[model samples]
Target chain A: MSTSFLHSFQSEWLKTRRSLAAWLVIIGGFFLPFIMLVGRTVYHEKTSAESTSPLFWENLAGQCWQFMALFLLPMGVILATSLITQIEFRNNAWKQVHTTPQHFYTLFWSKLMVIMVMVVQFFILFNIGIYLAGAVPALLLGTVDYPSQPFPFMYMLKTSGRFMLDILPVVGLQYLISLQFKNFFVPLGVGIAMLMLSLVMVEWKYGYIVPYTYSPYNFFELRGSAMSGSKDVNIHWLALSYFAFFTVLSFVLYISKKEKG
Target chain B: MHTIEAIGLTHHFSKEIPVLENIEMRVREGSIYGFLGPNGAGKTTTLRLMLGLLRKQGGEISIFGKPFEKHRTELLSNIGSLIESPTVYGHLTATENLTVWQKAYRCPKNRIPEALRLVGLHGTGIKKAHQFSLGMKQRLGIAAALLHQPSLLVLDEPTNGLDPGGIIEIREMLRNLNREEGVTILISSHLLPEIEKLATDVGIIHRGKMLFQGSLASLLLRQHQASRIAIETSDNAAALQLLAGNGLDPRIEAGCINLAAAEKPAIADINRKLVQHGLDVYRIATVEDDLETIFMNLTNQ
Candidate 1:
């Protein structure tokens, strides 16, 4: 990147401090793991019995993904993306940024990069939370011995990386919609409505077309459920394609807009 | 040389509704030019077009002798603007807000404190901009515009909602910037008296057309030419005849004998002649036209 573009990116990153998106990342990351930790401590006998299984770590990860992929990750992306994009609109600062020395591409890509980086930061926090959720129970309950199975660092990272890819289309679509409208509820409402539609169409033959369904469908497939639509199709590639399409379309529309503010 | 020049600028929201028409404006270097217009006279739109905030649908804008569209980024490095209301990030403190622009402008970090001090906001410390009073927020906006130390400053209605004291403060600051820093300023307002106080050059725009553009002295000269004298005497018909007979070209208008292009000395001479003609001059008032009256006359035309 050019120095000016890098500077624009740095400015965009600093703008997110104390923002709602920042809070969403922190709170969303710890939410599920904290719940899991609480549930295991309250029901130690069940957790202790479950820990004896050889797939203990894998089972715990699956449980986390059950909530995350179906709801938490998608909702987190929707809210965080909208909040970040709304910063300029909320403060009435879009015209201000446009008049700056930075180019149109710099403003567009820098803000998008900050949102994407925040998503990555969210994933890192979630992974650390997952580790704590699994380990805290083993430490707190004498009846629950540490799981005999080794920590699945590689498996956890691989699964987290896949989940990140699965949700990119959500981030892209939400960012695009958010940038177009000043009303926060508009994008949030669209995301919620699409997510519901995606859930209803998950079993349909062409459910892969709705990018929102990728997370839930990927989770169900990983849990050994029968893949809907074509059995040989890879939804990750579909997810990536949808992400690229929305990203490019939004960029074109944004820079060409006559009255950006 | 001119710091900014716009030629044949025209814009319309729709084919049937034109906002600006064939407008030409020249803002010279090291001069404070006040852009004057009533509400909806296309002042803000013209300023937006000059700064490239809105796409120019017609005509050319050049700043520092280069085409605005082809050399926008380079020209913008030396142009700072505050359009309409102040744009302040509610979540960030005053310092943080300037820091954001400091990074974008790639200016020295030290300029941030200097800018804050320039705007009397250095003492604000950690107060977020949303909490600032309207005047303070406007100040902070000006400070942000000055952060890059641009040679040209474009401000739209900078004194729109400021209290008298606040207006005075901003006026003095603009004067100092023009005098000390040699920064050219193009500030717009509907208030002629306000512009009369600060503007070295003035442009009066009305209904999407440039009515008058020149130095304040030339506009005052136009005001001088437009001045009139009004006389009410005991015998109004006889007084009109007597003044006209004396080659004063006086006529009755709105129940008074009026003379066009009358000067201060003409007021005394006309009064003395009326008394000598056995007509009691009840009142003789020299209506010296002000800038506001001149603005009204031009806009009315």
Candidate 2:
């Protein structure tokens, strides 16, 4: 049984690897953070006064992680979900899968694991690109004369990890939504709508509970600050709860119902 | 042992109407069984239920002496099926599609090329499935199903969109599989002649009911014994009078008399009697029971 499951998982992973959409997500994700780092470096090199600021490294880290949360993470989620589910829906291939020796849970999990792997790889590569891009410019410009704050690798890692953790709930929810609706636009449309609504609620001072609002909360908390004038919100607890809820919900939805081909 | 059996099978899409009502069918091992039905006759539904793709409302399905619902994964492992149109990934190459399904079934790697060769698609290298013709796609579907060397193969309308040559090739392939490999096959088709050529046993369905299920020879013999005699005479009135006078009232249609007869001598006797009655005997022949006639007779009744 384990061998069968592994074979199914490997086959699904191969399919995802060959997909054009997976390439787009990985390339676009790595590009976003790299672009932001380059923009910061050029702006600092062109203006010596801006380079003199002590908090420049912190600001760059802030921008890099924030850009990922806002744009790259959601884009990756949508791409991964659609890539995993669209082929099955378009070709009606689930009938073939259901008739095979592999169990339904095994089939479902193989696709889900492949999507999760894509997202995790994108997260790690994007952060590393951002770090290298930021570090090289600082070293090339001579840190002694520039006198900018030291780049905090640990803080960046911490913040990016938290940001990724916060997005886990939406990842699970988007996966469920993608499986529920075979069309690619519905999950994306719903994510964008919820994102815009969360933006409005964050300003209203009561939106900290929303998953999207946690994006900025994670960034600010990394800099040792709170966004809503309250330090009572436990970032670790919130991230853990979100991950648990979404994972459980996704499992329930997947295993409890009959999946038609 | 029976390769497939469904006892008192029932299915309904909703509470209002039943799609299949108390259906029962059996197919012997190492024989090709043809399921004949018209449009909306619950053929696809029956296949789905037998494959454990749908939940049975009531009844039991057994495959290779195992209950399908309880041992679904194990039973399905030994069965290869192509239920509807081939549900292959269009973006993947023919080889890639086979690889994916091969992994799903966990069959040995060597059987991949062997199955492809069996379907006459051995050398189409790295071409995406979308580029295949309708016939090639159907063959590819068959290749996917046969990859695991299953003991039983279930195909629903396998030759739906094939040309005559493609159809003949598939028919030959199926025959070879059954004869050479000893694989039991259950094929559903509305094409009577195609089924007549391939199937050893046949089951006819109408309006979600099994009208008849038996060997092809028995079905033909049953229909032949209840034979209809068509007699054409110059004086139709005199022939009708003579036929009814012999206690055999014939159905009259356009100067011809059609009536059922028990023996061949009765036909000869009717011809002799009509000739003796001063009527010119034009034609006297027994109508051989074709599938269409049998279908009409069974369904109309």
- Model 1, A79: alpha-carbon shift in Å? 1.5
**Candidate 1 lDDT:** 0.89
Candidate 1 on A1-261: residue-level lDDT in tens? 799989999899989988889999999998998898899889999988877788888898898889999888999999999999999999889988988888998898999999999999998898888788888888987889788888898988888888888999999999899989989999999999989888888889898888998889888877889457525678889889999999999999898888866
What does the lDDT read for residue B195 in candidate 2? 88
* CAPRI quality band, candidate 2: medium
DockQ of 1: 0.80
RMSD of 1: 1.9
Cα lDDT tens digits, model 1, B1-301, are: 9998999999998899889999999998999999999999999999999988889999999999999999988988998889999988888999999988898888999999999998889999888888998888888889999999999999998876678888898899899999999999999999888999999999989889998999998988887778788889999999988877888788888998888866567678888888888999888877787777778888999
* Cand. 2 Cα-lDDT: 0.78
Worst 10 residues of 1 chain B by lDDT: B261-270
TM-score of chain B of each: 0.94, 0.96
Window of ten residues with lowest summed lDDT in model 1 chain A: A226-235
Q: Highest lDDT, which number?
A: 1
- Candidate 1: which stretches are off by over 4 Å? A140-143, B253-256, B262-269
